[model samples]
Target: MNTVLETIKNRRSIRSYLPEQISGDELETVLEAALWAPSGHNTQPWHFLVIQDKKKIDDMSSKTISLMKKSPVDWIQKLASREGYHLFHNAPTVIVISGRKSADPLLFPLADCSAAIQNLLLAAESLNIGTCWIGLSKFLFDVPEEVKTLSLPEGYHPVYSVALGYKKEQLRPTAPARKEGTVGWYRA
Candidate 1:
């Protein structure tokens, strides 16, 4: 396999992380990779909010868990109730990704933002940094008051978050088996 393929195969959603923070250079490199992701009509409507403060990260995790406990989904409530569960998995750094509202109806900022997230994940993996794409943060984002704390620019809304840090374990887990019959071919 080629370099990209190898990296894609090796990348995994890391949940356990060391308490030590990632280097500034590494974070910057990962963010830069996100900025290069393809966007709809080249609008490039993504914003990144990097939070390195331990207190703030922990608070966010706590708040998110509180909200999750009220969720109708049984699994979410159970996960939230789990002892020692942290929304960001206690990573030293958390990044919130937002997408700018587009005037054009055809443009989908969420898709663009998702592409940026994938790039961010791949870049972090390439640097041997642990990362987890935090969809659970959406619980916090749904709350207007919680989102106001982020102070995002006008017309931008939070879409996803990523937790980043050094892995607690040096050994990488093997990739899980992929689902079968998911691919289709259309050849002329």
Candidate 2:
């Protein structure tokens, strides 16, 4: 198998990370990979906001946890703790992905952003960096103004985010198992 294919297959969802920041060149490589993701009709509707400022990152996570703990759901409120989830799992950097506000097609924005993030994570893996996609923060969108605060367009909304850093522990990934009858072909 090709090196790229191996990297893709071996990559796992990293949950724990070291405190070191990714290097500038490695960061550029990951960003470049994201730019190459397939988009609908070449619309490329996705945009990324990279956050590395310590104070800002800390503030954002603290505020997010504060709000989430107020949720009526007991499970969610319990999980919104400063112990492990503070500063977005304590990763050194975060890339907030958003999409343009338009009516071309609703699914295009999400699909494009998803593929872009896959490329980013794969590229990060190749560079020995780890990335974890964090979707919980989207709850902040419950408030209208968070869109602008995240540097999104007036109407654009956040789609997802990826936390990036070096892995603190070895990620043990199980082999891919076969789906008994998942594959299908039809021609008539």
Candidate 3:
């Protein structure tokens, strides 16, 4: 396999992390990779909010769990009620990716943001940094007050968050088995 393929195969969503923070250079490299991701109409409408404060990260996790406990989904409620369940898995840093609103109906900020997130994840993995794509943060984003705290620029809304830090375990987890019949090819 080639370099990109190898990196893609090795990358995993890491949940466990060491308390130590990642280096500034590593974080910057990851963010730069995100910025290079292809965007719709080259709008490049993504914004990154990097939060390194443990207090703020913990508070966001607590608030998100509180909201999750009120969810109608039984699994979500159960997960939220579980003891010692931190939303970001206690990573030392969290990056919130937001997308700018576009008037064009065909423009999809979420799709563009997702591509950026992929690049960020891959870059972090290449650097041997642990990362988890945090969809659960959406619970916090849904709240207007919580959104305001992020201080995002006008017309941009939170899309997703990523938890980043040094891996707690030196050993990487084995990849899960791939499902078959998911791929299709059209040939002329």
Candidate 4:
């Protein structure tokens, strides 16, 4: 099998991480991968906000959990109130990805952002780093004040975020059987 394909198959979403921070070089490599991700018309409408401050990361996690608690969805509320739950899973760093407002409106913004995110995730996985997409932080993007705290430039919108760090323990999740009936063929 191809090395890239093998890496993709082995990659898993890491939820637990060690307290040690990732080296600048490793983070840069991941960012470089993201920068090279395919974009519509080469708009490359993505900006990465890397937050390495432990205090700030913790604060964001706490705030996200607090907000989750108020969600009307039972699952979200319960999960938010559960003990030993951190939205970022105590990762040493968080990278917030934003889509540039100047991107062509006709082009796909979220899809472009997703491609960059996938590149970052795969790059981290290949480098022995762990990463998990913290979708729980999505709510924060809609809040103007919270967005300001990220210091994103004008005309940029937060799309998603990922927590990155060294794994605290080996993450070898049992392979679940893939669901069937999800594929289709259009060849005629």
Candidate 5:
């Protein structure tokens, strides 16, 4: 199999991370890989806010935990209990992805940003760097003003964020097996 296929097959969502940081070059390479993903009409409707500051990480985590606590779901309550209120798994770096707020803002930008995240994850896998999609940033969707502080242009918004770093351990969970033929392909 080709290297790309191997990378995809081995790629895993990394939640646990070490205190070490990823080098500048490796970070750039991963970001570059993300930007190369196809965008709708080449709008490139995506913005990445790379947050490495410990304070900012803590702030975001606090907010996410607060929101999760408010959630009526029992699973979230249980998760917060075991995880101790911190989200993003204490990853050393967080990349916040956002885009413009258009009539179909989410549809295009979400897809684009998701693709970019996937590219970055694959790239990180190749470089032995680990990344996991972060839900903390998205939890702040309740407050639009905070999103603006991220320097997103007018109408722009944050779609998703991914945490990056050198993980101290591998997550024990494995990807669930794909159900083939779930989506039927038909030729008439």
Candidate 6:
């Protein structure tokens, strides 16, 4: 198999990570890939916040769990009680992806930002860095106070957050079988 195909096939969402910090160069490479992702009409609507401070990351996770505790949903409440339930899985760094409302039409900015996130994930995988897109913790960024704490600019809204670190586990699990009928071809 080709190298890019191999990378794509092997990339996995890593939840367990070592305590070591990712080197600055590796972080830069991943961010660079994000910056280069294709955007709608070249609008490039995404903004990234790279948080490396463990204390700050922990506080964000705590706030997310706190909010979860008040939810009417049973599953959410249960998840909040789980032991060792840090939203980032104790990863050393997190990159928060956001989009500006004015960057494009309502949906385009989000689509562009999502493309950038995929680029970031693939780049990290190539660098032997582990990444997991954490949708559960995005609630932290949705709150008015949390948005202010994140220091996101006016008009910018949180789309997603990703945890980053080096994998602690040596053996990566193989990819599961892809869902059938998820693809189709157009022929003339």
Model 6 C-alpha lDDT per residue in residues 54-99, reported as the tens digit of each score: 9999999999999988888899989988998988999999999998
* Candidate that beats the other on TM-score, 1 or 6, i.e. the better one: 1
Tens-digit lDDT track of model 5 for 1-188: 99999999888888788878889999999999999999887878788889898788888778777777777888876776664556777888889888765576445777888888899999999998888887645667557766655676667677778888897776534877998878977799
Q: Please identify which of the two predictions, 4 or 6, would achieve the higher TM-score against the true structure.
A: 4
Count of clashing residue pairs in every prediction: 0, 0, 0, 0, 4, 0
lDDT of each: 0.95, 0.81, 0.95, 0.89, 0.80, 0.89
Give lDDT for model 1.
0.95
lDDT of 4 by residue, 83-172 (tens): 999889999999999998754568887789999999999999899899998777887787889999888888889989999999887856
> What stretches of model 4 exceed 4 Å from their correct place?
102-104
Question: 70 in model 5: Cα distance from truth in Å?
Answer: 0.6
User: Which of the two candidates, 1 or 5, achieves a greater lDDT against the reference?
Assistant: 1
The residue-by-residue lDDT of candidate 2 on 1-188, one tens digit each, is: 99899998878777777888888888899999999999888888888889988777777777778888998888778889646777377889999888876776545788889999999999998887888888777666566666567766565678788889888987555756767988899989
Give candidate 5 regions above 4 Å deviation.
Answer: 104-107, 170-173
TM-scores, all candidates, are: 0.97, 0.85, 0.97, 0.95, 0.89, 0.93
Off by over 4 Å in 2: 72-75, 153-155, 171-181
Per-residue error at 108 for model 2, in Å?
Answer: 1.6
TM-score of 6: 0.93
Error (Å) of candidate 4 at residue 174 is 2.4
Candidate 6 has its poorest 10 consecutive residues by lDDT at 100-109
Provide the lowest-lDDT 10-residue window in model 2: 139-148
lDDT for 124 in candidate 6 is 93
lDDT of 1 by residue, 1-188 (tens): 88888888899989999999899999999999999999989999999999999999999999999999999999999999999999999999999999998889999999999999999999999999999999999999999999999999999999999999999987897779999999999999
